[model samples]
Target: MHKTLSSKQLIINEALRLGFSDIGFSTVEHLAENEIHLKEWLDNGFHAGMSYMENHFEKRINPALLVEGSTTVVSVLLNYKPKLEQSDPEAPKLARYAYGKDYHFVIKDKLQLLFDYIKSDIYPDLEGRMFTDSAPVLDRAWAVNSGLGWIGKNTNLIHKKLGSFVLIGELIINMEIEPDTPIKEACGGCTRCIDACPTKALIGPYQLDSNKCISYLTIEHREEIPEEFKGKFENWAFGCDICQEACPWNWKARPTSENEFQPHPDLLQMTNDQWHNLDEDRFTELFRKSAVKRTKYKGLKRNLDFLKKK
Candidate 1:
């Protein structure tokens, strides 16, 4: 006779089958520590133009408030490591995460499917909401609380097995599950990520000033690139991976198995000329399903122009 699988085992198995690199569970509770840090970050205006970070102060820390009757927050990590690099080394660089389909949609879809499975087959009356970075969720904090990984000095979730090249998604449901213990901080005198930042975005260990972050300036900041940051971008035109690339944890990262995360042939072959002459039509065709779409054609051109000026 087969032994019945516990809800935790069932959930973990399904998550792995869905291509999640790892999964962890956490009880829905207020993130008091994260809340305090968030308040300080906001008070310092470190979020830059991302005003939405300030809108849901309470809901951001309380999982129960986001999903009524929620007791469990299941965090999943999907690795996005790239198998190939751009053929032209001098071409404007794109972040590894934007090489393929937008992860917000990819992870959110998986989370919804997981939600449906739990509701229909396991719990029957389960009510939950799936959250990617698209929501007000403090994804790293939740992932860390769920024992997914410790937040590194670069502020990315660093898994012992997968490094930090992974996307995080959460499923908050009304179910009690075994919660994983939070991992202890592991940076331990390592400051490679901090020292690697071109613009000094990592002000200190685990602290970031978004105003100076290359990823933020390239992807989120709408205005002209700040003159103060001239010659500092290092040719990044989409998102920057300098911090992650410098982290020792990422030295052993394996490429992702998800084919949808593969970089397009055209994207890999793009030269500086090709990127400079990128018309709206080609841009639309190449990034139609990519997270690079968030920057839009104009924003990408802005980033490219900034790098050109460097």
Candidate 2:
């Protein structure tokens, strides 16, 4: 006789079938512990110019606040590890995550399917909302609570199998499912990510000073790149991935199975001259659906010009 799978198992199996790297469940409650850390991070002005992190304080720590009557937080991971890198050794680099379509749309669509599966076949009355990096949700914290992975010293969620090259999404619903146990912190004295940071942005283990981070300086920062960060960008014209690249857990990271995450044909083939001569029209064509569009044409040119100075 076959053993019956619980509601949690059913959901997990369905999520995996939908091509998610992994899925886990957790109880919805006030994240009291995270509140302190978040407050301290905000108090230190670590959020930098992204003042929006200051908004929705209550909703960030509690899922139920975002979705009424929510009792379960279903966390899912989608691997974004690329199969290839830029072919030109001298060309400015882009963070692997920005190579493909914006993850917000990709993951949101998948989460809706998962949500529909839960309601139509299982719960039938599963009222909830899905979220990716959007909204005030503390994504990494919830992933940890759901036993998806532990937060690495670099502050990225690191699944033992999927590594850090993964994106997280969630479904907060009214139904309760058995929560998964949290995993152990596995960095274990690895300081490669800290030492690998060219701008000293890591500051200390598990601490990131975003004001000095290359990813933040290149993308989220709207103003001119600071002079102090000159030459520290290391040819990155978009986002930086030094910390994730330095993590040992990612050494064995396999390429993602999701074709939607694949880079455009010309993306990897772009040469230094092509990037340097890029115009607004070319930029639009190359990054038509990519996350790289976040930086915009002018912003990318700014980064490219900055790299030339080095």
Candidate 3:
């Protein structure tokens, strides 16, 4: 006779089969500790220009509020590390996360499939919703609560096995499942991410001032790049990855197995001159389905121009 698998085990097996790096479950409740930290961050205006962060105050920390009757938060991690790097060393850099198709869609689609499996094959009456980074959810907090990983000093989630090159997604459902134990913080005494920041964005351990973040300046900030940051960008024409790159845990990160996360061949081949000369047509062609499209052709050109001016 075969031993029976628990509902949690069944879900975990299905999620892994769907290509998620790992999955964990947590009981849904008010994230009281995280609330205090979030309030402090917001009080300091650390969220910068993203005023939407101020909205959905209560729902952000309470999964039950987002999905009525929700009792479990199923968190999953997907590694996005790439085996390839830009071929031209002098070319403006893009963060590894943005090298492929937008993760929001990729992760959400996978989550939906997981949810469907749970509802159709496991819990026929299961009612839940899935989310990537496309919501008011505290993704890292939930991931931590689910024992997925610890939030690193640089604020990225660092899985001991997968490192910081992972993305997070979630499924909040009205079901009770055994919760996993939270992992211990692992960045003891290491401040490589802080010291590596070209713009001093990581003001202190585990504290980031988004206004000074290169990733924010390049991708999120709608205004022109601030003059004070002129030379600090280090030729990053889009998102920056200095902090993650500096994290020692990521030194041994294996490349992701997801084909959807692979960079376009032309993207890796573009030289500095080619990037500088990129026209709107080429930009569209290269980044048609990529996360880089978040920064439209004009924004990318602006970033390129900023690098040239240095």
The residue pairs that clash in candidate 3, if any, are none
Stretches of candidate 3 exceeding 4 Å from the true structure: 1-5
Q: Tell me which residue pairs clash in candidate 2.
A: none
Q: Tens-digit lDDT track for model 3 on 16-122?
A: 99999999988899999999999999999999999999999999989788899999999999999999999998999999999999999999999999999998988
Q: How far does residue 75 in candidate 1 sit from its true spot (Å)?
A: 0.3
User: Compared with the true structure, what per-residue lDDT tens digits does model 1 show for residues 141-205?
Assistant: 98998998999999999999899999999998887887889989888999999999999999999
Q: Per-prediction TM-score, please?
A: 0.97, 0.97, 0.98
Once model 3 is optimally superposed onto the true structure by TM-score, how far is the C-alpha of residue 148 displaced, in angstroms?
1.1
Task: Specify the poorest-scoring 10-residue window by lDDT in model 3.
Answer: 1-10
lDDT of 3 at 23: 97
The digit string of per-residue lDDT tens for model 2 on 1-310 reads 1222476678888998999999988899999999999999999998899999999999999878889999989899999999899999999999999999999999999999999998887888789899999999999999999898998888899999989999999998898787789998999988999999999988888788899999998999999999988888889998889999999999998889998998889999999999999999999998999999999999999999999885
Query: In candidate 2, how many Å is residue 118 off?
Result: 0.8
Candidate lDDT values, in order: 0.90, 0.91, 0.91
The total number of steric clashes, by the backbone 3 Å criterion, in model 1 comes to: 0
The stretch of ten residues in a row with the least summed lDDT in candidate 1 is: 1-10
Steric collisions counted per model: 0, 0, 0
